[model samples]
Target: MSVAVDCSSEETADILVESQNSSLLENETEDIEEFFNVAMELAKNAGKVVRSAFSEKKNINTKLTGQDLVTETDQAVEKMLISSLKERFPTHSFIGEESVSAGKKCELTDNPTWIIDPIDGTNNFVHGNPCIAISIGLAVKKELLIGIVYNPIQERLYSAKKGQGAYCNNEEVTVSGQTELENALIYSEFGAHRDPEKLEIKFGNMYNIIMNGHGIRAQGSAALDMCGIACGEADAYVEYGIHVWDIAAGILIACEAGGIIMDPDTGGKVDLMSRRILCASSRSLANQLKNQVTPQSFPSD
Candidate 1:
């Protein structure tokens, strides 16, 4: 769990050279490991803040829509995470949910940047539910390099670095390898968007999955839902009207776990900034989901 970079050691350098996606030079590998370590530490500290504030009723404010709630704890946690991360990587940029709520820009750059959701399941957290987590994703040159999601309540830590395998609680994890949709467990989220047309599309997709798949779950947190797929707890996940922070970490985690994520609009390719995403335990299952379920365009807002 220690994030200390040891690329200087001959053994560490050999391992990186032999790993998947091992194209990175020694310096880049060291930089990425440093970032990953800093991010994991920040996520753990943020989890503590979340746990200490979970039991009490806190002030909540609406953002963009009534369904989107932001609590004082959310703001405080983001401030803490950003502050701590910035101190460690001063030149790197950050795009956090609270900063966006405060009218700051959410644009991503090709530089080393941190995409953070201080509390991914804010609504669930507000309701005293434990289905929440701190999602931290590190993107370098516009490519996700490291992802970490910590569910302090459940004490589940899911993380992955590009070219490295995915891990849950330090154990290597993988997708369920369910190729058939009918017998596959699926996960999806009803986003904050309440537009009737969008809602109809979401419900219709849910209905199709329900009648075809083994079961469907609305886990409230996109990060956790995708992590579920990464660890084989669920076979697939689909969502629309979500942001980069919501799915950034999950994308890397799922892919590192041997899962496939696609943009249904792009004929099954991936676009990180796409507001819509379809993911499954395997490439075959992803294709099945894409062909079986038609995607409807929603207001991107």
Candidate 2:
């Protein structure tokens, strides 16, 4: 499908091209536009740093538990981004995963804040896998307003603004219109560290889909998985245990791409910091999946 976008303003054009969201942000102040431009530039710069680190020796470390990992690249990129953003917008808040892991609480104030994951999918990066990203999201008054997710290896940049459409690589894209489970290609994340009972229920849901002739993928990056759905490459993506940074930008992209996002546990609109999520191309599919998965209960770990 073809999407029309105004390429008059360079900044708007760049965002439109990178995002493929058809709708342009209306009446944005020059300051907001400048901030977005800086964010996009910083995110791309961080991607370069990550690529350089990937090509050489990386100092890998563990976080949270043995299952979670971090790298020197993650910290360095975040520091660079935070510093640059602070230099430009000193009054703005910065919330970064690495910084948060270092025991810095990211409290949202009235000022604008940038939510960043300098190198998301550090596990993939550490393992020399290509499914990692740099996620940058902007929020004012704790409300998410703009977001950008870039995968350096793939050179795919997804972005969106509040009330505007989503985009990928300058093409206007939308979620697939597949309404049935049998026709859907779903993406999910499952790992060894997850609770066994939860795994069982998740497996049961997988089994139901398998019986319906649906396809399932377990790409490591949550940001990319949601982007995949946004670009209509995947019909849905669901994750039970994830943090806000993982899905923040992705949720905006998906919504602007005309997809539905919700908390899988409560079947409600997703809060910015929600831990569990169910995202689908359409509300019908989301409700169907939620219903099928709801009857099964998993023990909390």
- Candidate with best TM-score: 1
Per-residue lDDT of model 2, residues 160-271, tens digit only: 8766688888787888967777788988776424667877877887776666637888878888898999899989887766667787778778777877776676666454
Candidate 1 lDDT by residue in tens digits, 1-301: 0111111223343222112234543467887888888888888888898999999878999997999999999999999988998888899899898898798887777677898899999999999889998999987766677999999999999999987889999999988889999889888888887888878888988888898889899989999999999899999988878878888888888877877777766544455565778878866677767765667665331
What RMSD does model 2 have? Answer: 7.2
Task: Flag regions of model 2 displaced more than 4 Å.
Answer: 1-28, 294-301
| Error at 2, model 2, angstroms | 32
- Name model 1 segments beyond 4 Å from true: 1-26, 298-301
Candidate 1 clashes between residue pairs 3 or more apart in a chain or in different chains: none
Winning model by lDDT:
1
